[model samples]
Target: MRRSLAIGTALALAGALAFPSGAAPLFSGPTDDIGEDVELAPSSDYADLEDGELVVDLSAANPEAEGVNDDAVTGIADVFRVRYNGSQYAHVWLTHESEAVTFYAGGEPIESEATNVTLAPNESIAVGLRVDTTGETADGLLDEITVHARAADPEDVAAQGDALSFSGSTVQTRAPTETSRRFTVLGASAGETTTFDASRLALAGAAGDLTLDEVAVTSAGGSVSLAVDASGTEGARSRVAERGAEALGAVRVTVETGAVERATLRFSVPRGFFEARGVAPADLAVYREDGGELSRLDVERTGERDGRVRFAAETPGFSTFVVAADRARVRVADARLGQTTVAPGESASVTANVTNAGTAAGEQTVSVTVDGSVVAQRVVDVAAGDTANVSVPVERDDPGEYAVAVGGVDAGTLVVEAENETDAATAQSPENGSDEPVREPAGFGLRELLGLVALLALVAASLLLARRRPW
Candidate 1:
């Protein structure tokens, strides 16, 4: 009996040593074993709402007593550990007791938290967690996280007894990325407020999609005001306006894309656009995808007022419109006349070179003026970066020197000659050998007198011949 008692004592010592102080009890409850596990219900994805909740089912169990495993009737207590990298985005809690939750930011206890949930053998308890994300930004949390759950004995002291413990975790839920729909704003005048449908700028949301909480001008010298409908059924409105010299600069408005896809945006024309370009609203031109091989689209004017032009076009994707004015600058390059000297009842040809010095293309009128009178005029059509020569015919029946001008600018001169008197005197008195000039009848030259004398002689000769001839 003494030997048997000694053996029994030694065996008990060995058992105690084998099951270390904080280790699980050797004879844990009835089933001779301590077991526990945890699981999450539904899914892990969660909305970034101000207040929310999650359900976690924690179970602990011990089989029926059998043979040497006669002590399988025991209770279990579960402890949970919650960790979030962005504590500001969410204040997390586990169970109904506020003290049980550990805040990651300040390491303070949450208002509704506690630990050590008691459970019977082969029993399970569902614990709910409340989360708050009011302080979170539109795109606060961008990664996935896990909430840890551990099961252990409620009364098990450190380094003592069978502390039945097991660990399970649930992925931290996250909101879905926002995508779908498009955005555009009607053109606006500088320093003036323009209204746009803020709802349209918003990305389409899924059933529980994560969306932008606010719309703002990221780099533009512009201000945006939001008007949210309290009824929740009406779309929001946004008013945007440019400030200072930024109206002449490139401005942009930005929103969070929920890290899903690229954002499409359209902006209104700022006020002072027409004044800055020195062009009328009707002269505005829009182009897109016109570089290289792409063709230009026909942009339609929506409206214009107060030196501001608003227009729209079919955009293939998100991009800024190529806006500009269509106009041309015309000038006279050169003026040339075919003949500077001519006789009476003659004409001279004049050519004027017109050039377009502007970026736009159009037609111009070129006119030739002799002695301040518009003698000839023609239309000259020239394209951008090109020159056109226009021709005009000038007639001068009087004898004199005349000044010529083309397109209202002085060009050159033209001279016309009158009938010669020396030739007429030589023909009338060939034998006189006189250097004196003789006055004759107006409109009667030497050729005319000679023709008249010949005609009179021929008539006399004909009469004599007729009289001599017999009937």
Candidate 2:
């Protein structure tokens, strides 16, 4: 009878140890206590625990979960709890096969080098998760993360039973919520302009400074829906500075449903943003940043009202739009005349070298002035950090020496000579013909005639004297 009672007691103890409530068998062993020793449960912060698995929903209501927008990172703390239910000290860590999500324990990241934390008997720790969504465009699910636990001391024989546990939970992510505005074009003809107020698309948080007041779309006929959202200016300040401009603000604009022939966006500028920077309304420009390239857009000043200035830009497609003033330093460096001397009614070429030292491309007027009067002018286009030689042809019909200036700088003097005078000078030059000195043709003069007549009279008197003496 005593043997029977001992056998029954042993069986009860074995069943109790091997099949503990709310625990799963981790491995098969000779000992009765070979079972899971770590428990995973939902924390007070999160209550979506189902069957010892945690479920998280990243939404706007959960402000602690950040990075709910495009080109952002998501971080959430205290996602769940990990408790060691073993009798001896054990190391607890998390393992996952997800590239998008990383797990953390007790505020420390769980990497290969630093994976585990020593948890005493019945101690618990909080777990967190981080997701990098820098280029993530779609919403999806994160892979399951397994909670692992093992004995801290390898040689502890008593810790052999219930030494390891492998359990995990599933994570799901939703699309980032945004405030948007939609406009519908009904039976619109081609080249027709439809306007809509998008003031409701102002985003909160870091990009709250930017607001889209209105949007005008030039359509290509048919009905279409256009949805617009304003994302913040996270890295726009430095980008504008790279282009030698000052960023007032920036926003990401997206178009949906159909293609637009043209889109005009009107937004408000910060009070005194231009005045403080000494930028004029005409100096304000809009640029679209796409694929790491910035292209300039045509912008117009929409006037100022209520202490605020407004501007409009015709955008080519939709992307990140920035409002800035390009500080283009365009000026004339020097000027040169093709020739210092020119014939009357002939044209002289005046070349002006224009240099752009700023970070933007611009156009400048190069004028050729003769004696303080503008004789010719031209518009020259110069890119940033480049130089362009603009040539202006000038003509002068009058013959004179005139001081010439180009692009507001003195170049040199221009001499205009008459055609007849040029010909006469060319004829007198020795290089034109003979090497001998020039002489006049032979001719009789008054002095030679008078001497001849006197000689004749003397000869006649002598002949008459001789004849009278002979008789």
Candidate 3:
């Protein structure tokens, strides 16, 4: 019995060393001065996380000096370190703007893999850290993570002897942590009811056997009908009905383990659902459910709208979200017709300017009416608060006076006239209908009489010449 007790004690001590019991949180407060060498804040705000999963959180902000922008500090350098009871069970993954921030495991900057970020003096961006367990062994207690800040490079700081400040947080994981636990919503149809299988809920970590307590689906800023099937052999399933109005919303699923460890499942507002509700495809703001108001949630849009808007969200826990925007309204203006007069057998064109005087973009048809009858029409697409001219061609085959209108509004008139055949002929022949008569020369001048006598002499001479020729 003594030998067995000794072996058990040894194993327990070894396991404890591998997975420490007490560790700091996963985040630290902000470090204001990079030149000040300091220790990490040894407290954390996170209590639970799964293995092989990353939970990123914002660090606490350092108190700002009066009238000073803390983000203006130049050449800010960051160094990350993980402190534990001499076990490599956990590794710290650091990032800036979704890019890796570490070179090697020791918080060394990778020259090639480094992300060079420059923030404006007035602009600020938060650095992120992801506590990832190797999942090699369930050993945890990988406690404190310290992020050091400096005004210069590590080498320069070493050479120039500038100081650095650090902040830290504790990290805790559920015992026997699984690689991952995530839930997927499948077969969601936009503008229609969708049912998801509960049995297929992907559960990981120490609590793989997850039980659905309840499901509540509500619009972020709208309304929805949600139902959950808790009494099922496979697992808890969910069904969400279509929203009656166009708005952003989310479906939150509350789940529990046999030990009663609670976790919530959250998803972004599906774009297809919003589109089915007549929501225009514009930039949508994502918000996580807070107490009464929703807070912004960072998400990546998948740029696809099938039955649902597909997107990926990284968060510490499950929560509700709202994808929201102002609804757009479209309106048509009174149509105006231009250049309504034309001759017969010619085409007369009418132009009406279409305007969307509302906040929404839409298309409107502007028709041309001749003598209270629809003759020609055109479709005009106008953006919100914008206008476009729609042109319709009216053919005047016969002569008549036609009243022109657009969209039932009297705009102008179209007078088609046949060409005046009599005037046209008179213009072509000016002397055809003249009243003056033909007249001879006013006087027979001497030259005219001499010419006549010469003509008679020539006739007599020609006769004589002919007689002589015959002899």
Q: List TM-scores for all candidates, in order.
A: 0.33, 0.35, 0.30
Over 4 Å off, model 1 = 1-282, 287-298, 302-309, 313-322, 359-361, 383-386, 419-471
Q: Give the winner by TM-score.
A: 2
lDDT of 3 by residue, 17-87 (tens): 01111122222333232212211111122211223112222222211111112233212222121222111
> Candidate 1: lDDT of 117?
36
- List clashing residue pairs in candidate 2: none
Q: Rate the local accuracy (lDDT) of all candidates.
A: 0.36, 0.60, 0.35
Q: Taking the tens digit of each residue's C-alpha lDDT, what string does model 1 give over 1-471?
A: 000000011111001101111111221232112211221121211111111112222111212111111122211122222221110112122222122122231233332324333222222232222223223221122121222223333443333334322221122212222222112111111233232333322222111111122222221211111122112111111110010010111112222111112222232344664565576655544333222222233546556544434454443432222333556667788887788999888988887789886546768777688898887667777886688888777878899999988997666888998868886566667376765566656878889899999999999999999999999
Give the per-residue Cα lDDT of candidate 1 at 147.
Answer: 23
lDDT of 2 by residue, 410-451 (tens): 788889987786777678777888466654466666788999
Off by over 4 Å in 3: 1-272, 280-334, 369-379, 407-409, 425-471
Better of 1 and 2 by lDDT: 2
Best by lDDT: 2
